[model samples]
Target: MTQQTQEPTTAELSAGYAAGLDPREVAETILTRIAAREPVLNAFYLHDPAQVRTDAAASAARWAAGTQRSAYDGVPVTVKENIPRAGHPVPSGTAIANPPVAATNAPVTDRLLEAGMVILGSTTMPDWGMLSSGVSSLHGVSRNAWDPSLTTGGSSAGAGAAAAAGYGPLHVGTDIGGSIRLPGTWAGLATLKPSAGLVPLHAPYLGRVAGPLTRTIADSAALMSIISRPDARDYSTRPYPQMDWNKRLSSPRGLRVGLQLDAGSGAPVDPEVAAAVQLAAELFAAAGATVVPVAPFMSAAMLTGIDAFWRTRSWADYRALDEAAQASVLPYIARWCSAGKDSDGAATIENYQRFAQLQQVTRQATESLDLVLSPVAPMAAFGAEHPMPSNDPDEPMSHISFTLPYNMSGQPAATVNCGFTTDGRTIGLQVAGRTGADEDVLAACAWFEGVRGDAAPDWSLVP
Candidate 1:
């Protein structure tokens, strides 16, 4: 066929192959898009056009030989910088000179490669995945696709930006606390943070998990099925029953949904954000689901406790660095790390106790509901270079009010674009399910996509 000029979804690319479109040609189109947009978005860290062409050519040969590896065999995909890829340095978005190239691929990377997906490149992230904005001392800032002046939420910053800008149909991101969903919300994309242990972690932490960010919930589900496979290297990965997530999309007719408008942290929520979430709840009701408004069960004290635990964990990482290397980190991250450096065993125990209390409260609140809906972030995308919208210490943590608690509870949570603000900022609706109900969470997201329509930002207007 004629050379393609526009971005195609993962499903569209697969169908094109059946209609005589060459995978190599599709790769060429994607590479061209990356070249044109990378300067504006700064989404990628290490992309090799020649290497991608080589992989795409192999995929074309497989298709011609009727030996395709998977439905997404020829589709382009991007991985977050923190996720290891063989021969690429795991910079974790730092300025360390001559970082060692990874000798092995992360489990999620390996799964994508085995599925015959063409790797577009690795996306940028915050140093040590510590911040909520895209700016990193090593990679600069990853700009929001809708408005470059605004920040792309972190630590999955580049992943969200890339997906929103139509760099590819699928991208993978890691989240300890709202990293994936936050950016997904700000960029007007779909993202999933599966329950802990559902997706294997390269380096295990209390609530860290790797998941997909895509233009649509269907694309996210397709990638999720592949990456969620068991990996021997990650012993924390639990055995998951095989199922077709693509088929799980249906009307949430009888589902019980709880609407939480405010996170109860006294953090201000933009009117547009609240309206978008309420719209989602209204849509669920219109679709015959039972919807009820619920007060935030998570308290400010519980959030502070969780934040302390995260800071302590970040402090451990910072302390492992040499004095000279420590000086290379971003000021905010350094400050964050130092805040917990003096934390003692007593503080750790207290944080854990508070965490348990939050978990217990969350369990009771969500015990009778199929899903809970809230705004992914209290506000939309803010300044691209700032760590947070406000200088107040509590403001940064408060922004994650709706998201961090689920991380503590180890429940599956996702975000989908609901609507855009009056000034053009994107808004997202968060949908979360009980622990071990990742598929259910995904299904709810898909249902919302059906109601809202999976319309991503028009990247052609960018730049």
Candidate 2:
């Protein structure tokens, strides 16, 4: 009745058996939960019931043979529609690719499959992973299970929503520009945007990397272990760290934590979001992580430049299509794509310089710290009716401000639920790491989750 208290899947199972719940039963229970929630939440692009059974059966067999695939074996997992899965469509939420057929599973996706995580099907993303808010003109909008009117942050919108709603115990998503972190934050889930290139992007666009969204930090780490494997199929993947990611680590306190609360947008981040971030900074300091407040978050010019480069991407590619093909895309995606086609390279160049500048500054600023913490968004998820902004792609676009810097800097960044807005929308606290300090980011985030006591935000108890 009251949702089987959510079972430990994959990595979660190793630390301890979860109330005697077997991985097989966990998969079945999650499928049942998905059936009950998907109609209202619409979290998945499509799921093959038979495939779930086949994968689960294989995982159970592995478990019986004493050779269960890592922690996630048998876990029901969902991937972002934008990530190519062999023989499936990776639409990027576009009408042009409505069928989203993929010739091969993305390297990151392949890693998950190799680990024995069963795919529940694909979740939605903004058209071409463009929109800042979850509202994709293509697949309609992925509602925030926490607050339907608001959003399930995106371009990993449905990925976050699905995880939040208990559709899958684990979710995989791409984050070129907060695709993973944003939706996870909005949906009150835990997510990581590994340093650019940490995970491979075998799909057409090369900048994005795959990361996981989940109910627990351990689940996220487990998913990462599967997805982070360097693959010969994709040249883009980095070699796996020589160290074991599963090893237990020490607390983050006593570690220097830089706080970056502002961005180049020059617009004020919501006060509530700010307070929540400060609370996080304070928590780190109190717990022994040295928290330093950094001033004048990235400049407005830098902010605008970063915003344009990341936001304009989906559209830049969109212009190559004919009118009818364009029309076939989501309304908002079409609108956004239209805007990008006209914007001169100057738009991208400005973003490029800002990116270089930010990387320089980010490196300089954080040289003293182990990590930087900040707000995920200025505002909480707005109702579905609220028109998601598609302002000029050139100047600092508003929503992407809080989340896209990492995409530009190619650094690891994470979003953990910090606080909820007065309206009940969730506020996300982002923690970014020095270039390639991804596991550290996850370790710190997991430590925070352990202290926080909540995995995904329990909306009913948010207040």
TM-score of each: 0.94, 0.89
* Clashes per model (N, Cα, C within 3 A): 0, 25
* Each model's lDDT: 0.84, 0.70
Candidate number achieving the greatest TM-score relative to the actual structure: 1
Give one digit per residue, the lDDT tens place, for model 1 in 313-415: 7888888889878888877778876778677999988987877787678778888999999999889889998876664443338788888778778888999
In terms of lDDT, which candidate is strongest? 1
TM-score (C-alpha, index-matched) for candidate 2? 0.89
Model 1 local distance difference test score:
0.84
Instruction: Judge candidate 2 at residue 168 and give its lDDT.
Output: 60
Q: What is the alpha-carbon lDDT for the whole of candidate 2?
A: 0.70
Question: Quick one: how many clashes does candidate 1 have?
Answer: 0
lDDT of 2 by residue, 168-276 (tens): 6679888766678877667777788887666766752434778889876677777777777676665655664553556454677578888877765645687888887
